[model samples]
Each structure stands twice: as structure tokens, then as C-alpha cells.
Target: MKKKTLLEELRSGTAPPFIRELAGEENMDPADLVDAMLRGEVVVPYNLCRKISRPCAIGAGTRVKVNANIGTSSDYTGIEEELAKLRAAVEAGADTVMDLSTGGPLDRVREAIVAKSPLPVGSVPIYQAAVRAQEEKGSIVDMTAEDMFRAIEDHCASGVDFITVHCGVTTRVLEALKNNPRVADIVSRGGAFLAGWIIHNGEENPLYENFDRLLEIARRYEVTLSLGDGLRPGCIEDASDAAQVAELVELGRLVKRCREAGVQCMVEGPGHVPLHEVEANVR
Candidate 1:
């Protein structure tokens, strides 16, 4: 029999130990926190595979959390440097850290970071899939859906606390982008990868199509899914465009799926926003 997750505990009207601690940290009643979590208004992004000593909650009534992105690029693949950044980010009060490395022994780097990070660790597996495609198959477009799913599974098995998946970038969202063009078509890397793959393959986004497989992997490891904002506005002018809204609608549906699957999730938003638009974006 599978063990009940933190979410399952809440669903059963009980607060997990970590939730109790987090509620106390937030000065919120544990029952209130559990209720908010049940309503999909809050997320506790911790993985059962990796026992997080420094657990924290994100979403309603929690302090504004900070997640520092640290990783090696293809151009500058320094594992040590990335580690230094991870240390600095944690020291500087980053609530979490994401490993977005696209270069130099990616697996080794990820393992090192996960081993060292006291805070929750997140990743974008699509980056690894794309990079592997480029290295092995000679093109990013050559990567198969299997490749992508395999990468996601690998990350989960590696005890990645959470992952960003661009499951909202669907064929319909692509059409929306075509019908209502923006200054920047798609600014997110994972979004671009899926968009390009969909265009090349003449199919729906694999992440969207195979979301159940994703849910299965996440459920096994208790990995939180950070549904990537593939159609996120790149520029101030592109904010709140139809394509963006379309993807957001898709994400809303995915959120419901996550909740039903008893998998934790949070939505990632636009890369850039104007000062006035920040409030609207958050809303």
C-alpha cells in the first residue's frame, strides 16, 4: 500500500508535522493552512524522497518567498561556481533554489546541488531533454516525447523536490499565439522547446498530452510540479495577451488535475512585467 502524502493527510483532516511547523512559522492556524492547501491556494513543495530539513510553504498568507536560480550554462559550465551561487542564495535568504543548468556534466552538477542544498531544489527537465537531444540526436527537435518523459523520471528518481513542466503549451495555445501575435512570441525556454517541437512534429504538446505520466512520476516521489508558463509575456507590451491567457486557462485545468492526483503544484508566470502590471499578474 502507498503511504498517504501530506496532501492526503490534509484531505483526511489532519495536519502533517511539516505543515504544522510551517503554519506556526506563518502565524497561521494549522487547520486554516490545511484548508488553504485543500483549496489549491497554498502549496508545500517538498518531496518524500528527499527529506527537507528546511521546509517552507508557498502561496496564500505565506511570506513572499524567494527562489534563486543557479546553474551552469553551456557557455560557462562551472559546477563550483554554481555551488557558490547556491550557497550565497541560501545565505541571502532565498526560500528555494532551482537548478537550471544547461551544460557540463549536467547529471553530476544536479546531484551535487541536490546533495548540498538544504532548501528545496527545483529543476526544468525539459532543458535536460533538449540538451541531450542536441548532444546525442544532433538537434533539439529530434528529442522524442519518450526522451522528455525519461528526463523527468530521472529527475524525480534523483530526489528533485520539484520540477517545472511546460504542460500548458498546447496546440490550441499555439493557434492562439498565431491568431493574436505578440512582440515576443514565447519567451520561456521550456515553452519555446515545446512550441518548436509541436510545430515540427505537427502534434500537441507532449507534456500536455502525457500529463498523467507526469502525475504518476510526481506521485511516486511526491515531486511538486511547477507548471511552466510557456506563453508568459516577455515584454511589457505582451502582457495579458490572448496567447498568454490561453495558456493560463490550460494551466488552470492542469492545476485541477494535480489536485485530483494528490500531487503538489504551483503556476509559474511571466518572465518580465511592468511595475503596474505586477499586481495584476499576481492576481
Candidate 2:
């Protein structure tokens, strides 16, 4: 039998002939299904480097994918333990892995897991930057912007496939945050550090002000950027407040710029959102 193109499936109101044949079945119209598939709104996020056994599309006309986050924190685990969690997550069908490790030997931990991961590995470069800064300089704000960029470069060199950069936390947002009243002010460690650094140094955030440089680095490594939501509401009461929405608006614009530069980007969502507000938060 001849294989049916997407166009052919659209004209009929049933499954494509190929799908029917694959199931050793018949009676399904190929045209309608083919039309649906050819709408061109679907996206499959499989990187050439990631050998996905059951790859799926992510955009319109596909099932929603959920990601599981697992990493070592300063107070609790070690690399070995984190790796065990990583293995378990993959076995449990996590689409990707984000290393939020803030303890022990950072680089060694990241490298070991990256080497072991078959799926795309992601990290918040800011976390490692702060961790190293506290170790060497005793305070995160004491670390220069150059140090942060260097940490980002190192992570890219170490084969991290994607990184979360909080480039939306601009000086303007910091200024607004200073005046905004919220219960969980500055819940994000990276956001708080950048805001304080800007206030203390009287300078703009390096990530926000120097985003082009960040894009260049990402382009060089072919690494995707998960634009971190620095000002994400920490609690339900604070959700969609001016400061949080301000950061999100900025991030949306930045996403366009990143796409234009051929650097793959996705927006990181909020944390601590109440179950009732989850849909609104995502929207």
C-alpha cells in the first residue's frame, strides 16, 4: 500500500491509511486526519542530540508535556543521591531534567549528571554563580557581573543543553519592586540577588542589560534558554501583581528577540501558585 501524506488524511474524516495499516486495521478515512496534521502549528521539541524513544509534539494539536525537577540542595543531598533521583525521574518519564543543585562540588556534580543524562539537561546558571560567589567572595552581590557570565560560559562548555537566565529582572523592575508591597517579597534567590546588586551598585542587571551577549553565547553552544521568571509570585495572594506582571511582560518581549536570534527559548513559570490560580498563572 502507498503511504498517505498529511494532505490526504485531511480530506477524509478518519485516521490515515498508514496508521490503520500499522494497526493491522482498516475503515478509517485518511483525508481528515491528514488535514489536521498539516495545520503546521505542531512542534516536536526533540533535539538532534536527544535520542527520544517516544518523541511527542508540544504545541497545538498535541498532548501537554509535564517536566519533573530534581537536584541537590545545600541542606539536603549529594551528587550521588541527586543522580539516583535523576535516574528515577527519567524512568518515571520526565521530558527533561533541570539541575538546581546548590551544594557540594557544583561543577563536578553538574558534569557527572550531564554525562549520564540522555535527555536534555538544564540548569540555572545563577544558582551556581551564587554558590561559587558565597564560597569565594562570601556574598552573592559581591561577585561581579563578569563572574556570573563566566559561570554561564562554563556551564555551556560543560555540555549543559539548556540554561535558565533571569534576564527579565531589569533595574526598572527592581525599582518597582522596592515600592511594591507583597507577602513574599523577593522569594527567588536569583531575583533577590540581582535586585540587591542593582540597588547596591546603582547599575542595571547584567543579564537584562547585556542580553545580546548572552544570546551570542547561547548561539555558540546551541543551548536553549529557559528565561527564568525572577519576579514570579511566591504565593497566591501575590499572583499577577504589578511587579510580577511587569517581569512577565518583559520576558514575553525577550522571548521574541531570542527567537529572532535563533536561540531557542521557553518561559519559566511561577512557583508557589495556589491550585486555584495555576491556570491563570500560566495564562
Candidate 3:
């Protein structure tokens, strides 16, 4: 018999330590949390390989969670500085951290951050793939689907608890974006990377097309997939536009797939929304 996965355990009516910890932290019942997990209402992103010291739950009925992103950029490739930011974010009560390193030794930076981080660590593997493509092939458009998936698997193998995948940035969504142009266009770097690849190669987004393969890796490592919004509004002026809505609709499909696969998943929303539109956006 195969080993039961985290999701399988939850579905079997067993509450794991992570769930118990998160439920206790949130002052909720463990059985109720297990029910939420089974219903795909709660996600506890804990890699079995990585021992988490600060486990926080994200989803319905839980207190709002905070995820702080700290990583090295091309302009500032300082791992120590990023580490300092990580420390500060944790001290200031960040529930999780995402290493969006796009510069310097990408793997080294991620390993260092993940090794030191007590909170769950997440990453955008496409960023590493895009950076590798630029360094080796001279452009983000040169990043192959194999490179993207390889980076994702490597990140999971290295104990990343979660990952942000721009699975909704499809050819159809690009058509929607074209028909209803936004002032900001595309603001997500990973989204833009995949978009460039699709347009240049005339292919479907690999993350969207080969989602089952992605799920296999996520299931093996128990990595939660944060379905990214590639066409999310970069500015208030572009809030609630057709492109953004289209991507959200695509993400909804991905979320359903995730539940069917028994892999934890969450939807990533827009970058900006006006005060008046926040309620609508949440709805």
C-alpha cells in the first residue's frame, strides 16, 4: 500500500500535527479543522521534510494570514539583507515567507532562506527558470516548459512548503487581455514570463496544460499550489477588469482540480484595488 499523503490523512479523518497546531493557534477545534481540510476550505502548507516552528493556517473562518515576500533582486543581490528582512517580517508577525529571488545564486539564496526560516517558505519557481533562461539563453522568452517544471520540482525537493504557479495565464486569457486592455498590462513577472513563452512559441501555458504532472510533484512533496493571478490589476484604475476576471475564472477551475487531486491549493488575487472596490473584489 502507498503511504497516505497529508490530504489523504485528512480525508481519512485523521488530524495531523500541523493541523492540530494551526487549529490550536486559531482557537478552533481540530475535528472542525479536519472537516475544513476535507472540504477544501483550509490549507496548511507544511512540507513533511521541513520542520515548521511557526505554523499558520490560511482560509475560511481563520484569522487573516500575512505572507511577507523577501528576496534578492537583480539590482540588490544581497542575501544577508534579504535574511534581515525575513527576520524583521517574522518578528513583525508574518505568517509565511516567499523567496522571490531573481538574482545572484538563486538556489543558494533559497536554501539559505529556507534553512533559516521557521515559518513556511514559498517560492515562484518560474522566477528561477526565467533568470536561468536570461543567463543561459539571453531572454525570459527562451525559458522552456521543462525548465519551469524542473525548477518547481527542485524547489519542492529542497523543502519549499508551497509555490506560486501562474496556471491561469493561458492563451485564452491573453485574448481576453487583448480585447480589454488594461492600463498596467501584465504586472506579475512569472505571469509575464509564461505569457512571453506562449506568444513567442505559440504554445499553451505549460503549467495550465500539464497541471496533472504539476499535481504529482505537489502531491509527492505535499507542496501547496498558490494559483497566481497573472493578469491581476497592477493599479486601482485597472481593478475588476475583464482580464482580471478571466484569470480568476481560470483559477477557479484550477482550484477545483486541486481539490479533486487532494492537493492543497489557494488563489492569489490582485496587486491593487481601490478602497471602494475592495469589498467587490473580495466577493
Candidate 4:
């Protein structure tokens, strides 16, 4: 392939075909558009391995994308049911999918979905470790740091292109949580588990303590890390509390670290933030 350029497409009168087709009009030169796409200012997120009919960009100049989460829950659904939901989300125009399956044969379910999915697949490895602990041991708090890291490695080895790590939940933040009074504290399952474990074990979160190791795994697989907001408010009242801010600050530091280490990272923000605070939360 001579590698189609924006200029060539424009010269051929087929530049930005999708955009023009949608607008029912055309104006831009193909070569100029190709130049834009080549710059990091625009991105075509489609993995060459995943054949996408309607490709999209996800960077500086692209439209904001929405991700739909679909997965099996312990009480109600199974793999087959979740797979149906995955297809439904894609059909409904979801830009991405995250398998937040905390129940029902986690590995088997993840593998089946990833193998079948044409779009990128994401996951939270902590959920798998917690589930495994409950099944194999007695409690999530009993899960070893090694157990958690192993699960992360397993997910990467299985071809998960992205992962959410609640590395912001540090021992100091957990201590702050004990002192802070809020309406709904620690809403994230992974966060709650790590908080409980830290309180019980009287140690720092392994994810935070061993972030370099986590980065190593991610760098090896080129997996993007969605740094989870473990202390994200569960209710409007708890929004942007001390614990939350503390975690956010820690995540910012980690983000820089990941960037320095050549690993991709994005911070996950609040869960129950008020509508008014959304912009500030993003900023």
C-alpha cells in the first residue's frame, strides 16, 4: 500500500469522504487533511488488527468518545448475556468497552469477549483478584500483593489493550478517610477493597507502593493505564473531599511517572460528582 495521504484523498475529491458524506457537502483538500492526520494532533484509533468499517480518532482534535461498560455480575448475568450486551453497545455506537466482570468465570469470560471483540478491550484487574480471593480464600482483604500483580500480568498476557489500576488508594489516603466524614465514602469496589485491606493490614496499597512494577507490565504490553479514582465520591455531598483530592494529587504524580517511563496513562475521575462540578473535575 502506498499509504493513503490526506492530500491524495483531497486531490482525488475523496478526502474526508465520511465527513463530506455526512454533511452532504465537500470542501477540504485530501493531502492537507492527510497532513493533519499524520500530525499527533489527530489520531485514528483503529488498531490495524481490528477491522473497523467506520474508524474514529481519539486524541487532541477528535470528538469526545463515550465508553459503554458491559459485563456479567455475580447475581444476575453470565458470559452469553454479557456478550449480547457488548454487541448491543457497539451497535448503539459506543466507542469502547470495558469488561467489569466481577463474577462468573472471570478469565474465561474476558478471553471469550476479547477474542470476539473488534474494538479495543479494557478491564480492571483488581476485580479479578478480589473475585479470585473470595472464591479461593475467604476475603478480599486476604489477597496478597503478589496475587494482584499476577492477575495484572495475566490480563496483559491475554491481550487486554487497556487496564484500570486504582493506584491512588494509598495508606496515607486511607488514614485520611478514617478522619473525614462524608455521606458516601469510597464508592469504588476496587478502592473499597484496597482501603479495607490497608486498614486491616496497616500497610500501603501495593498498587501505589509498587507502581513502577505496574508500569513495567503496562510498558511491556503497551497497555494504557486508566488510573482509577479510588476515593471518588459516592454521593454529591462527598464530592472533592480531602481523601478524593489527596488521591487525585497522587494520581497526578503517577501520571507524570508513567509518562516518563513511556507508558500511556489517563486519570479516571469522580463517580457521583454533581453536574455543576463536572467541568472543575475535568480541569
lDDT of each: 0.89, 0.71, 0.88, 0.74
Summarize candidate 2's per-residue lDDT along 154-231 as a digit string, tens digits.
888887777888898988777677778889887887788788788878888999888999987877665677788889
RMSD for all candidates, in order, please. 1.4, 7.6, 1.5, 6.6
- Report how far residue 72 has shifted in candidate 1, in Å: 0.5
Error of 3 at 92 (Å): 1.7
lDDT per residue (tens digit) for residues 51-132 in model 3: 8888778888899999999899889988899889999998999999999998888898898899999999999999999989
TM-score of each: 0.96, 0.78, 0.95, 0.81
- In model 1, what lDDT does residue 134 have? 97
In TM-score terms, candidate 4 sits at 0.81
Give the number of the best model, judged by lDDT. Answer: 1
Better of 1 and 2 by lDDT: 1
Q: Tens digits of per-residue lDDT for model 4 on 1-283? A: 4433332333355645554432222133434334444432333322222333444444443457778798888895588888898899888888778899988888888888777776677899999999898888999899999999999998887777678899999988877787897788778988998998888888899999999999878766657788899999988889888898888889889977875664556678867888988877765
TM-score of 1: 0.96
**Order of candidate numbers by lDDT, starting with the best:** 1, 3, 4, 2
Question: Can you tell me which runs of candidate 1 are displaced by over 4 Å?
Answer: 273-283
| Residue 129 lDDT in candidate 2 | 85
Decoy 2 TM-score against native: 0.78
Model 3 TM: 0.95
Regarding lDDT, does 1 or 4 come out ahead?
A: 1
